[model samples]
Target chain A: MTIDPAAPPPRPPGRPRSREADEAILAAALDLLIERGGGATSIEQIARRAGVTRATVYRRFPNLTGLLVRAIEWEYRNTTPEALSWPDVPAMVRDWARHLSEPRSRRLVRRLYGTVDDLPELLRAYDAAYGSHRGRAVRNTLEHASAAGELPLHCDPETLQLVLSGAALQHLAAYPDTTAAQDVEAYFLAVLRQVGFPSPPPAHSTPPRRSTSR
Target chain B: MTIDPAAPPPRPPGRPRSREADEAILAAALDLLIERGGGATSIEQIARRAGVTRATVYRRFPNLTGLLVRAIEWEYRNTTPEALSWPDVPAMVRDWARHLSEPRSRRLVRRLYGTVDDLPELLRAYDAAYGSHRGRAVRNTLEHASAAGELPLHCDPETLQLVLSGAALQHLAAYPDTTAAQDVEAYFLAVLRQVGFPSPPPAHSTPPRRSTSR
Candidate 1:
């Protein structure tokens, strides 16, 4: 027997906003960012490229900075760690280094970093978001290592998290053009080895217990 | 008998550039930076504060970025490292941390880092200059430690250099508002302890050996 047809949807609105238009605008922003850098990307240009009016773009995003930020977030979401599986600590670190050192990622960082002079608020927001998200992951990794005895019992997990995240960010800042993936991996391994991780032969030494006197 | 008198020298064609004016401008720029963030400091305001015409300021520096950069370099030159005798590796680390974590140093770094987005060329020049100067000091310390058998013999000095510098910058960036000088000292001490520095009690159960593999 044939199934009964569902009732038709109600048409209460004049014209529904198009999801395709939103995606198009985001894509156009990403393209512009890749081609001209972040400072040069404009909402008007994005609207024109997406075949939408400037008002439509503004209606979606309150300001240029907001639009740019969302566009970057969208691109980052699409091209980040979500799609990939990280099997082990070393493998995960390698993946992270590779992703961060890519040309597109470097350009995005350079563009955002350059905006700190004129847009301090945006810079603060970027740092806050980046730290909150990435910092948590690094902290979790260190904590797990500590719990598993992969890290020293005396290891300060918070400090380790800070060092890992900070070291990674500073490495990117200093060597924007060069991909020191192997060096980064080796550096972390050295740190891990220092922190009582067993590699080849077991770690030769233990970290000292805290001293009572300063 | 009386000696013959020397002849008077000829007057210069034009008044030599005023050292006082240069010093005044630099001092004013620094003051303005401390009061207002780097982005808010202007060449016109700096010139007015220095009691020099805009043309004179331009004659000294091509633009505001150049002026600010020169002022920063001047500040760096004036702040020479204090003559302190460190009794041990931990003591040295503590001294270094205290110096960098001071309010004056933090303010300078915040201003420079905050402005890096707007002035890429200036920022590049600043980093290159800062790195070269700081790198030399770090190299000396590392070399001394290696010579004294303080560091792992197989450790790549350049890699260690990168790691230490990256770590220091990251620490500063992470705790921009924190004045926990002791915490900085403790953090480095932990790292040093992990790396097998010769603490008084020698906490490690066994001695660390240089790794054979790269």
Candidate 2:
């Protein structure tokens, strides 16, 4: 049966029970994860929240870890796939700003990072699924920037990626209340500039020369 | 009662039970927090691990949240008090390198970041307890660097701090197995130089002048 990804499944009369149940389960798991944090979330709680029987949930997901992984996959499935095709660094930066502005996104990321110790597999699964792809996209953009002379001579793309990721995490941590997308974008741009990434595409400028080694 | 911070109390014979219990409870809580992650930890589990009655645990810590907060406090109490008096950026950097080299420390930090959504109060208590003082120390160091002309003309210490904190978190995430202190120090120094922090105390260098506005 064909399923529309965006449209909510039609009311009980027409919707496929299996697909509807899957969405409910995934959404419920995500909600519980964000609301209570991951530690307190349980299969029983998820089942209850989703309005589905434990047997039904178990039929689909073997365990809580599997369910959590699927739920995260569902949550990010929409965004990460297209991230690789993003046209330029600025567009990616804008998207990052918009996503980081959402309180839910920030909370979700925090919860994910929290899983590193207890459920290393969950994060590992996530990284394998989407993080690597997203990383490649960013690296491609950075290499393009380096080729275009937008980055400083000493800047390594790999190190820049680390610094940029760190800046994003730190910005989220330090300014959780700053929910404005523009504010987030401004902060990101500042970090980029501080790391010597020329923004707004400096026009008619000479290629960057390596600063003299001290 | 004056309790010695370093030595474990004399075993059972003339030792005070309350202090011993407190130590056991705190230690157990920290262990569980690091080992299993925070969500799965419970008072019953902590009490069991600590070999104390739930009532005994409850008598000291009124609730799980309070207990968790206290556990975190106890975890950091020994180190934070001395952090403010660190002599210079290099000393602090070396200490940071040493701390990040420990797998336990990396896991603890990831777990702490994870708490931002579910148990923000836990992190907030931690921040209030130690993070602010640490921030002041870093800020003071950055200001001293600026005064000494060790930073670039366009550098903002606040932004640099954000970038540095982000970089640390990213480094921990990206290279969880790089447990050598020297390697971590090198990564940190590279980051510092990338951000224009002029490491190895540049010999008699002229003060930085602002790069032309883009």
Candidate with top lDDT is 2
TM-score of candidate 2 relative to the true fold: 0.81
The positional error of residue A49 in candidate 2, measured at the CA in angstroms, is 2.4
lDDT of each: 0.64, 0.79
- Docking tier of model 2: it is acceptable
- Residues B41-117 of candidate 2 have per-residue lDDT tens digits of 79999999999999999989988878888888887786655656566667777877887799876776676677666
Candidate 1 chain A, run of 10 with poorest lDDT: A78-87
Model 1 residue B210 lDDT score:
83
Q: Please list the residue runs of candidate 1 whose C-alpha ends up more than 4 Å from where it truly belongs after superposition.
A: A1-54, A78-85, A110-133, A152-156, A180-187, A190-214, B1-17, B28-42, B48-51, B79-88, B110-131, B152-157, B193-214
| Model 2 stretches with alpha carbons more than 4 Å out | A1-15, A79-88, A199-214, B1-15, B80-88, B199-214
The alpha-carbon deviation from the true structure for residue A197 of candidate 2, after best TM-score superposition, in angstroms, is 3.1
Q: Per-residue CA lDDT of candidate 1, range B1-214, in tens? A: 7555685565664544577789889888877775555667799899899898889899988788778778777776644433334544556677678877787766666556544545555455555546455566666677677777777544545556655666676666655546678887766766555444444565686779889899
